[model samples]
Target chain A: MDRQRFDYLLEAYGADFARWPDGEREAAAAFAAAHAAELTEVLQAARALDAALGTRRVEAPTPDLLSARILAAHKRQRGAGLDWRAAAALAACAVFGVALGYGGGLLAPVADDGDYFASAFETPFADYDGDEG
Target chain B: MIDPDADLVRSAGAGDAQAASALVRRHLPRMVALGRRMLNDAAEAEDVAQEVFLRVWREAPRWKPGAAKFETWMHRVALNLCYDRLRRRREKSDPDAGLYVADGAASAGDAWLARQRVAKVGAALAQLPERQRSAIELVHFQELTNIAAAETLEISVEALESLLARGRRALKAALADVAQDLIGDADGVPRV
Candidate 1:
């Protein structure tokens, strides 16, 4: 990296090579080593700024209540999801039952209604007449 | 990209309690940290974290590992939520909004001094423009890679670097005195 790029990165990322772009960390470190005397002031200034900024301690401990609340929401969501799925499954079963009934009726053998009715009467009448005779 | 959170997200989506808890364990603190930095209020930061996770639960079922990782998406969501809150505060124009309240029970000595220093740094950070502050927060504080930070901010890498530089420059000027104090105390002990 050139002086201008190195300076630019140093300004942006500070003295921590870890914060620098991965590809340029080696080059930036090498440049700093090669030009330590010239870059000392700027590096020190960046370090100071880094140190100053570091003073703001962000202590964000996740409270148990918050975690419980979030997980409870997830549970509620999962419950709602389960209810929807169950409803869909029940509706599917109803549809399948109706379809099965209709299909079975359609597939049943047809019969001659008049002949059947007459045969029913004839058999009973014949039995009565034979008994009377 | 190999998303570390992909499996957890998928399992959580399918109602895996362990996975859901694991996801929360991994990301809740960071989300809270981001919100704390952006909003400067612990309660509000917690609210933001809750809101972000609620959105996560909603989207988890449909979360597709796309261009961004889950964590990156989460940071974006947290930031947007913070932005929304910030905008509302601006609209309300509350004079006391976003001010850090010192704990009454804080004991004296180094603890109090450290709290003061923290407040000073926070105040200096508050002076920066939102984008610049966000750039510094993401890269420096969150320790996100430059590429990831740029993606989180939805800006080009070059633009992200520019923002970082500008932010750092402004912070250097603002926190000069504090920096000196922090660099070396009266006893010449480095107190970073």
Candidate 2:
């Protein structure tokens, strides 16, 4: 790994370098002897990186997170349909309330005209209870 | 509600409330993973992932299939979200989550031996740049093809290669020591 060749390898492979070709093995070995100093620096730096990253561990997604995710999936499955049902239910309730209120208002004239009807009946111009029985 | 991915996407696009939640769940993991890799923090990753999924789910009706894979699209959505996160998110969080290797006492067994070697490799992998980390995870670790990985990063093949090369170089530098430690004298394998 001469300075020039080493630089080329470093450039060619960098941190993402792959295993050398089988044919390149003999050549690399020969070069290694000629430039052991450069090889050591590059190789050691690479090793330290590997060691550091190797020791940093991560567990699989936690059981709680998995369960939570699944639960969320289920909730989503249940939720979209519910929105429409809720809106429909709300609309029905609104219509029902509106109709009820309108009908109540319509009956107000009847309630308010009771005195007028009673006066007319008492004057003998109309019958309040035509069939008293 | 229905299968969030399909049902909500269909119904919610047609304007349904319940569909939204289903969509959220369906897309959450990728969002989280994207965020995890981008921000390198679970809590922050969750937040960013949630945001991405929510934004995409809102537009699910407009989602056209055949143009892209669902997972790929989700990844794109996430990477973009993570880009934003990377811009503003602090780097104070833990490093073990993003691109990392396993750690523990290698017990006296073959499995331990394999783990010891693999761990060294993983540690070496961790020292890579985020783009390199992403590429390696996409290519080597996750087994995604170059094209697929490229799509996820929205980069061309050549660009992906560039990222991969740098990543590999970093790994080579990092792992050389472990290789030396394991290999015996004259860079030979150590005696068992």
Candidate 3:
């Protein structure tokens, strides 16, 4: 058989591939049925291998162990997160303190009248009164 | 299949506890099986599997989703673990280069040709090179597509075919002895 056809047949008969598309699988199977004899010996060999490598499933770690490990790592991570959050919070507080001390009017103006008096004191009328007095 | 909550992968990568357990639970069995087959020693395989997952957890932060599949990458990681375990097995001078047992599997299973009748098959397998063994294992046992299996081995598909052909021919010749054992009373049975 031609290499291309044979390759198709191999795919059809199946190799130890983890997954394959359906249409391709069907095509391969058809090719193999037609060329059974020519492919027999090799197919048998492959089959034997397939049989020998069985899926002997093993045990996973128990939940407690899993949880302990997870929690341990979680705790460590939590601690790390706390540290980061603390650092960020401290930085934010420091910035706020600086703004309050030096930025002036750290809070929005609560009284509307304060600015009016301050502006009025600087006006020409106030200057004239102060000079006359 | 991936963990539904890949958040575990992220947290575990960054050293989260519950995430670590979840990651372990999600991956341990498959990894163990891979390790078991690769190293052929259950304990050793378990250790390798543990190490593989640990590395995966460590690598979670660097995972590039589109570059390649996360599972394919994991398979590659498992393959590397297997290779490392193979080397470690050889270093200690264990017999058969650490190939796993020829567990009896049904011929009907995945259309597997039964090894129950072919004792020489296992021996021949043990005698084959590790590359050949991996090629066989992935294709026959794991049932991976040629291209995918090749990727797992970091080899080209043509190279995989070459290895398989060579391996098959060797198996046929090696298993010839079992011909007698299989057809003890061949009088009625059709002859080739």
**Candidate maximizing TM-score:** 1
Residues A12-93, model 3: lDDT tens digits: 3345322334436565566668887887766565554344333222233433553355345445655776799899999999
When 1 and 2 are scored with DockQ, the better candidate is: 1
lDDT of 3: 0.58
Worst 10 residues of 3 chain A by lDDT: A53-62
Model 2, residue A58: distance off in Å is 4.6
Q: For all the predictions, what are the DockQ values?
A: 0.41, 0.10, 0.08
* Predicted structure 1: lDDT: 0.85
Sort the predicted structures by DockQ, highest score first.
1, 2, 3
After superposing all C-alphas onto the true structure, candidate 2 shows an RMSD in angstroms of 9.8
Scored by lDDT, the top model is: 1
- Alpha-carbon runs more than 4 Å astray in model 2: A1-59, A66-70, A73-81, A92-133, B1-40, B46-62, B97-129, B179-188
**Residue A127's lDDT in candidate 2:** 39
> Could you give candidate 3's per-residue lDDT for residues B89-174 as a string of tens digits?
55333322333334335346422333234223545655668788677666665556676678778898768877776775676566
lDDT tens readout by residue for model 2, A1-133: 4567555444433323333333444666677678778677775554444334333334335334643554464456457657879999999999999999999998875645778777766767453556758
- Score residue B125 of candidate 3 by CA lDDT: 59
